[model samples]
Target: MFKVGDHVVYPYHGAGTIQDIEEKDILGEKLNYFVVFFPLNHVTLMLPENRVKTSGLRKIIQPKQIDELATALKPTESSTSKKDAARPYSKENETLLKSGDIMDAAMVISNLTSKEGERTNGLHMEDRKNLDRAKQFIVSELMLVNDLSEEEAYQFITDNSKGA
Candidate 1:
């Protein structure tokens, strides 16, 4: 269970602070929940205490792990032909993001992000959505772990993703 004031990555919702833990009656059962508040969106999320693991809630990745992720981002390359099959690749990226492995997530984003002269019309809409999802996951996690603003994180990732 997460204690108050802990920084946590809340999946696609990005990073949030655990403001409080409260017990509420639901269907005659008392349930303990974490009240997480997102500073970016100014929203609150109530997460079931028992479902944290299942829901993919996790602590911020360690600084050493971030270094590993940065190293992984330094060499982002994917065979476009292999990714031609949209659904499978997209699903794979989604899984990578959900895994909460920053390096894998960065690889997925770098794979999907287009360069200055690159073309994207050939890519499927689903693939684009998946790419956005993966980028969001990585950016959000990076922001929280590094204590950076969203814009800073985006710019940093964009700059770092070029040759990765």
Candidate 2:
């Protein structure tokens, strides 16, 4: 279980801090929930304590792991072709985002970035959205963990890695 003020990744929502744990009566039953604040979107999320395990809540990557992520982003080949590289390609990037696995997240960044074409010009609509979401996940985590600004984290990724 995460304590208040702990940094955590909330799957598709990206990184957030546990602000508080509140116990309240809901539906006539008392349950505890974690109040998490997502800095990126300026939003708060309340998650049931009992559902934390299955909810994809995870601790942020360690500082050393940043280098590991960079290594993972150093890609060779994952997608089949540039034309069909969105949606079902690279597992939709949905599975990886849901896993909350840092390495998988890195692969999302790598795979999407490695796609041929500039930006969303040649990709399917869903694929473009997936790439944006994947970048958000990486950038959000980098902001808190590395004490870097949003632009810096993004630039870090662009400089150290390829593609997106």
Q: Candidate 1 — which pairs collide?
A: 75-164, 76-164
lDDT of 2 by residue, 1-164 (tens): 79998999988899989999999999999999999998988999999999999988999988988887888876546546544554345455788877777677777767766663443666556666776777778889999899889899888777766642
Off by over 4 Å in 1: 80-88, 114-122
TM-score, cand. 2: 0.86
> After superposition, which runs of candidate 2 have C-alpha atoms over 4 Å from their true positions?
78-91, 117-121
lDDT of 1 at 47: 96
Report lDDT per candidate: 0.72, 0.79
Angstrom error at residue 120, model 2: 11
Q: Please, what is the TM-score per model? A: 0.80, 0.86
| Ten contiguous residues minimizing lDDT sum, candidate 2 | 81-90
